[model samples]
Target: MLMRTGVALAGFYFVAQGDWTRLLACFLAARAAVTRLTRPDEEKPHRLAEEVGREP
Candidate 1:
């Protein structure tokens, strides 16, 4: 959440200041932040199945 908010603030700041280079870097960081935000929790199904298998 922080990363996303920081990126958005930086984007507005950079655009307002007409700083193209930093804005491009912000865009790159945005890609990573969005990817992280969208990724699903990958461990839950495996853990659930293992626990079920172990119960009598």
Candidate 2:
């Protein structure tokens, strides 16, 4: 969860900075989103809402 948050935050920061070197924003965003979407409900170790907290 912490990893996900950090990735998303950093991605947004890079996007706002308009730095192509950090175009990793696109990659991070896609990865986080794909993981969230593909994770099985029962496979999750914790409650969905609790683990992910809030979304941007």
Candidate 3:
């Protein structure tokens, strides 16, 4: 959560400096980090099973 907030703040800084490309990249990275953090832990077992070629 802290990392996501930092990334968002960096994005804002880029925006203030008119650095559109870096801002967009930072925003995308922050979104991906948040999405990863919020995902249900229940999915992990299924993912691990798939990785090991086993049924979940």
Candidate 4:
């Protein structure tokens, strides 16, 4: 999430500087980041805590 945020912020810089090529590159990179960000986490840390909490 942080990485994607940083990449998006960088894109704004590229746009401000009129770097079209890099801006396009950032767009592609952001797409890839979004793919990962949207994917379900295979190693969710909360699962363990939830399982423990459920043990009344």
Candidate 5:
């Protein structure tokens, strides 16, 4: 949620400052980074439950 909020804030800031090229580049970079970072770890709801010491 925090990561998403930061991305949203960055987008609005870029738009307000009229930096179209920078906005596009930043968005692409973020997309690539998120894809790479999350690719190794597939989410499973059951795993999350266990992590928090709960049963699924």
Candidate 6:
């Protein structure tokens, strides 16, 4: 999430500088970062078994 925000800010800086190519690249990078951050974590198939074996 923080990384995404940083990328967005960088993109804004590029826009302010009139660097269109860099701005586009930054936008794409930010979009991908946000997408990855928002994605759900994959479930571990053996989680229950592992938990059951962890008795101290």
The TM-scores of all predictions, comma-separated, are: 0.44, 0.39, 0.55, 0.42, 0.45, 0.46
Q: On residues 1-56, what C-alpha lDDT tens digit does candidate 4 reach at each position?
A: 99998976876676747677776776788788878778786644466678788622
Put down candidate 3 lDDT per residue, 1-56, tens digits, no spaces: 99997976865776657677876776788689888888898754577787999977
What TM-score does candidate 6 get on C-alpha atoms?
0.46
Could you give me the TM-score of model 1 versus the true structure? 0.44
Regions of candidate 4 where Cα sits further than 4 Å from its true position: 1-16, 41-56
Best by TM-score: 3
Pairs that collide in candidate 5 are: none
Q: Is candidate 4 or candidate 6 better by lDDT?
A: 4
Question: What are the candidates' C-alpha RMSDs?
Answer: 8.3, 12.1, 4.8, 9.5, 10.0, 8.6
| Error at 15, model 6, angstroms | 7.0
lDDT of 5 by residue, 1-56 (tens): 99999989777566657677777777688788887767744453467677899866
- C-alpha lDDT (0 to 100) for residue 32 of candidate 3: 92
Q: How many residue pairs clash per model?
A: 0, 0, 0, 0, 0, 0
lDDT of each: 0.72, 0.73, 0.76, 0.72, 0.72, 0.71
Runs of candidate 6 exceeding 4 Å displacement: 1-11, 14-16, 43-56
Backbone clashes, candidate 3: 0
Which 10 residues in a row give candidate 1 its minimum summed lDDT?
41-50
TM-score-better candidate, 3 vs 4: 3
By lDDT, is 2 or 5 better? 2
Count of backbone collisions within predicted model 4: 0
